[model samples]
Target: MPTPGFPPGTLDSEGDPIWLTELASDDPNHTLHVVQGLEPAEALEALGAKPRLFRPCVLPEVKPDEWTSLPRAALALDSGDSAALLAGRIGAWTFVYDDAGHTLPHDDTILLSADGRTAASSLYTINADASLSYAVNGEQLAHLNVDDLDLDEELPGLPAELRAAFEAAGVFEIEDEDLEPGEADYAICMRVVCALAGLTGTLDDLRRIPLTVTPFG
Candidate 1:
């Protein structure tokens, strides 16, 4: 058998579904990153993105399934020289979305970027698999392959209040076992990290929020 507190393959392995399954607009090939206590512009600046005014042309009326994806194509560069992101504030966290799938929490300096606060990323691939990573005060607390019910122990830098909330929410896995048909441990793990950083709002809430566009190098 594979390890119990961990999963069988890479974090991107095909296993339990992630928050991206529901968090995404209609596609899974995207990234959502959260930064604590920052405004949208501030968060992008900290991530080393120099955001310029990117006024896209009038978007075509898209089908419901194409709602989010279609808007992103307008943000893409014809030369492919840069990446784009949509950022907005929700509660105490700034949520950044990159339909291009390039974002900070996956970068080499991810931990350093969390020098004073927390940063977390939840990713899902086209293979229909997911993974999570998080850092606090420049220290990486956890990076897990949250496949099925196979998750690591309680996160290292989790706040006491958040821990309490997770406990009450039944977010902690008390045992190690395979997941049921529809159980989503990946989403559960993302929820804990987001809660720890004071992030609130569903994907729909985020999609509806007025967001600023930032250009990523």
Candidate 2:
């Protein structure tokens, strides 16, 4: 006498099957016992026909403090500012990194590779006195207000080892005289970018590929 559409394993009160029509006016709680074996979706569908017998329940709203935190995240910024808000989690700690200044509020757009393995960054800044300065990674790489080659031209007298390192690292082209605000900012940005690029490349090469083996045997 059970409902025709009800799947196997459905039971009845008093251990006796009850006709589907008999459940039309029966209490939902009672009918639910008979259809307990049905899949959740099917059970819901079957019970839906009797609205008065069953109603969907709503969950309580969750508070901000109740939500779990993510491991890696970043801040987004609007145009016009030279900087972007930065926030994320590393290990179990959260951090925020922002810039100083207003006019050119470090509004920079950062782009990362498809796998999140690489990133490119840039930003512009207007100092406290309205001087335009820009930086990347922390080093002041460039300043827009000054231009002179005196410092770079003086590199000939520098120690050979120091000069060689600068040349090899492409740092030799930056002259001390060109160390204006804008240039300083550019230099800083370049250093950070280069270092990050090198580190990423080295890590990826080491981690993703197998190392060659040399044998005395």
Candidate 3:
């Protein structure tokens, strides 16, 4: 019973994305943040997106090719002071992707925005350091390092049930035995965080859909 748009065999045999037994992804190193109660434009702006780099020419009838089209993923702004990002909404969640910025949108200015929206930022670095952090109503919640899933005490304002859920999901059982660990754990972290944020649609949906591309350099 894999979620309909999700690739077949992605979920565990039990059909749970949170406890995925195997996950093979080509694009493993990226930053994705899903914010609650924000539209794509608002989320990007709050996350420090600069003004849209509108295409210079207006072709009224011709379909814009990839060269002229808004990029589905980060392009030139992967380094320096800014990052290339695309933000889009799926249900109540707005998902933002940063090509190389592992800490994108986790900035307090965005997560702790005066507008009061919250977000869950998930990062999977090339070094296999995976983490998931939540921002709620201007407060930074526990930032869980997937490799070290240890919570000695209850995190303030974090739902007790969510903590229990992580425990029950065996997220604490992750080990560093293989050549590249945390890949599966990264998927688990993303699914769990997105689920908690009430984000609908598959990860592929976010990657493929038409989103607002913002150049932040």
Candidate 4:
């Protein structure tokens, strides 16, 4: 629940806005949302949101010992950052997208059902370096290395049209010769999939009615 009269847009060390309120899955089995920015407050509002639309949630965590750990599916500040401390329970499959510097919050994120037909997509341009990625029935639908890709090759393995669509988004570049994309590398792939499937809805839709963000958080 939201704390009333909370004006949004508080900034953090990286200059990303702080999220005072949170969005969560209505079903415990589907309660996973991946917020793109360092703090997702701006990401939430850019989608035309007001508070109290969702249950506040933090990524669930676990303690195995004196040490702490996060699941591999949790969102990371960067691919190399060591903070999986916030692994969530959207299940084994994960959904990936970007806030694109908080420019298109609603279009920037998505949650899909097991069937892959029902989905919620925010309308926004993904970050230049962000990858679009998702899963269906625990099957990963995304590949890596947009630039190194051949239409049918393992580099991307996307259908030609989808691959072309992602290519238009600008591949995340790298100087390393042998770098393989990690989980975050798939955001752009998922973005193109959303556009192709017409899985998008207006941000206003979320404010007026209840919706579910699925797959993984």
Candidate 5:
């Protein structure tokens, strides 16, 4: 069975998620920290004194007639200094094992170019059926394999309703253009995934984690 901590496949027990309060430490590479659960208000309170950032971590649950197979939660973290932080925000959750020179939980993995120019076509599948495919670009990317719908051969702009849905589901943002394709793909996929999960909204309502720093005093 999947554990209740972190994500389904990442931990063995329900421990408070770790928060990095300092950038430098006695052992920067090996340092460990713990964060106890806080209510949304309390979390905001903690952020008042420190440069803390928040991301939603979803608890896993089974859903009936759902197209996606995996259960997931959002993970909010500091987005300023570390590649790991940026990667987490973009939906790539696996950790790199330097010793192994590889990443874990290899399923549905997508790799992005450093400058965000290029992205792999199938880093992750949507709707569980893998019927649709996607390619990323600056304004909007292609959503292919849409066998379920047949409006026209031409790529249609995201409908107002779908756009609204994306926003309402906490997946939309104006800063998306500045993000790399991989990061953009992560955001787009999350919005679509939430839609498939029966959540409502347009992309505009999607909440994004702000880039910030934290200091321990």
Candidate 6:
């Protein structure tokens, strides 16, 4: 039998999900990231003695379901000098990586954009089938090959184009054992973002249109 998977909900001490790679170092280099549930004062404290403060701006909306979007309130903290310390201390948890290169676990919605003209949000949440639902930009685009997605339920309304894209992105797997949703969903979302946004999924691309990541408490 394929090696047993890490117990469900398992995470490293840093709060990084078991499936995600940790940052090589805590040094900041303008990479996109998110810190869940830090108050302004606490965030400021995390920033250090001095941190460039941008006027508070509402964070991007996270659609937990098709009809509801959670509007997160946040203060924009400029990198000023470096965001490493700020990133490390601002929250109980942090979901960050190089670029659109992350699979947010638990209930995190990270917003990404290419040129501000178009955007996509990768949402990872548990589905009714006990499998993870990885929806892009809150759009419920399903694949016709339900087996590839490990979908136990039917999705009569799945769009053909999305199915085609998933195939093109090599989302289908022939594993002998069950696989965690992160195994395919993260890479699939990366490819889908490229297909729909017309931009290579990279840190530079996101820098051009920085993410407005809002964390829920």
Lowest-scoring 10 consecutive residues by lDDT in candidate 4? 20-29
Is 3 or 6 the stronger prediction by lDDT?
3
TM-score of decoy 5: 0.20
Error of 1 at 41 (Å): 1.1
Question: Candidate 6 on 1-217: residue-level lDDT in tens?
Answer: 1111222233333222222212122221212223335433333333232334423223233323332221111222222312222122122323232221123322222222111211222322223111222234433333122235542233334355434333444432334536563345333443432333232233222333322232221
For 54-171, candidate 5 gives per-residue lDDT tens digits of 3333322332222211111122123222212111122321111011111211111122212232222211222322222222222224443323433232224654433443333332
Model 5: residues with Cα > 4 Å off, grouped in runs = 1-156, 170-187, 196-217
Clash pairs for candidate 3: none
Model 1, 40-95: lDDT tens digits are 77776666667565342332234245434533544544324455566777777776
Better of 3 and 5 by TM-score: 3
In the range 61-102, model 4's lDDT, one tens digit per residue, is 432222221221223333233222211112222222222222
lDDT of candidate 3 over 163-194, digit per residue (tens): 54343333222344341321334445555555
The per-residue C-alpha lDDT of model 1 at residue 121 equals 72
**Alpha-carbon lDDT, every model:** 0.52, 0.23, 0.50, 0.29, 0.24, 0.29
Which segments of model 4 are wrong by more than 4 Å? Answer: 1-128, 134-136, 147-190, 212-217
Model 3 alpha-carbon drift over 4 Å, by segment: 1-27, 54-82, 102-105, 108-113, 151-157, 160-184, 203-210
Best by TM-score: 1
Q: What's the true lDDT of residue 168 in model 2? A: 31
